[model samples]
Target: MSGTILDRILEKKKDEVRKLKEQFDAGNESKFQKIPFYDSFIHADKMNIIAEVKRASPSKGNINLDVNPAKQAKHYEASGANAISVLTDEPFFKGTLADLKAVRDVVGLPILCKDFIIDPIQIDAAKQAGANVILLIAAALDDEKLKSLYEYAYRQDLEVLLEVHNEEEMERALVLNPSVIGVNNRNLKTFEVDLGVTERLLSRFGKNHDRIFISESGIKTAKDVERVQKAGAKAILVGETLMLADDIQLTMNQLKVRLR
Candidate 1:
């Protein structure tokens, strides 16, 4: 509350991490197989969709508060989504690890634990809950923490989606050389969104076949998909638009433009 949204979220995450450490049981293994998250985008001919099961966010108060995580994930899988991203931060996003477990139980597709991860304990918890991938936001962590967490997730056999919003964050993220990199259009600090954020970052770095590029947030239409696709985004992570869609399958299909 004293700082920006990102700062406030990170502060809150510290408390969550402490609680996670208190109750997390590392010996408990996930029942699901660790699906390859990055490879899905690399092999796809069309724009890969990491369809998100997000109930709410700091920016949008409540999108779909009553959505059943398992049922929603099934819809995404049936609609050709490459992966499923489950927002697991309960305080801000109104999502919990239980939602992730529910989605994992129902979908064969790789599941991404979309949370502001600052500690290794969160990664352990995600793995225990059956997440195949975890998000590492550049804005939420410094250089040291970023590298350590990125390495830790790999050691846990979990994929890391290193997310960046600007040129500086992108520079920091590149040092890790993560297999999958996402250009988030939403500024975590301000909560403002712009699809141009993806275009600018990709334009600056150009395309790297070795690293799967994903454009996250603010993508709603085929035109929005094409805009980022032209800028060399191989995949996209969509949340609110799909959550509010009257027809989930049709909305997903519309956003999944063929990769150029």
Candidate 2:
């Protein structure tokens, strides 16, 4: 809260990863199979929604503390979300691996374990938690660490959502030739949201961007969904709006926009 929000989160994440590693070391890793997160996008014609089950965020505070993650995930699947993103960060996001496991048990859709992942241990933790995919933020990792983690996740048969905020980060992310690329409209350090960030970065890829392009953060209305789709985003990772809605499924239906 004092320094940059991202810095604080990363500091906490380092400690969290250490403890998680210890926990995994003590317990046996779950025998899990990777679900197809990217395949759904490839087979789908219209824009896809990767609805997130996030309880809280450092930027937005507590959005919905009492909601059951498993129930919410089933609702998202029924509402036509292509995939589910579960926040596994406990301190700021108010989530845990238990939330991911619960959702995984209920939803047939692919589950993405959304966290500030910095270590290879967390990737193992994600697989153990039933994540078909794991988020890798470009800004948090150096080139070596980024490539190392990306390869490590692939070896475990987990797809990666390489998230980037700016041109430089995008360049680094592209180097890995990631299966999925997320253009985050929100700045992790400052917590500022801008829908145009997705547009500007994705514009460089034009209409034929080969990788699955996902616009993350700051998406609220149907118009917001339409704008990003027009900008060449194949998918949208939405959280806060749906989480605070009067009816989560109804809100998702209203936000659904088709492109093609």
Output the number of the lDDT-best candidate. 1
Task: Encode model 1's per-residue lDDT on 1-260: one tens digit a residue.
Answer: 66898888889899999988898888887767879988767888899999999999999899989999999999999998999999999999999999999998888999999999999999989998999999999988999999999999999889999999999999999888788899999988888999999889999885677788899999889999999999999999999988989998899879878887
Top-scoring candidate (TM-score): 1
Q: What's model 2's overall lDDT? A: 0.88
- What is the Cα-based TM-score of model 2? 0.95
Model 1 local distance difference test score: 0.91
List per-candidate RMSD values in Å: 1.0, 1.6
Those runs of model 2 whose alpha carbons end farther than 4 Å from true positions after fitting are none
For model 2, residues 19-82, the per-residue Cα lDDT tens digits are 8777785266666666788877965776789999989998889999987999989988998888
lDDT at position 56, candidate 2: 93
Which ten contiguous residues of candidate 1 have the minimum total lDDT?
Answer: 204-213
Taking all chains together, each candidate's TM-score versus the true structure is 0.98, 0.95
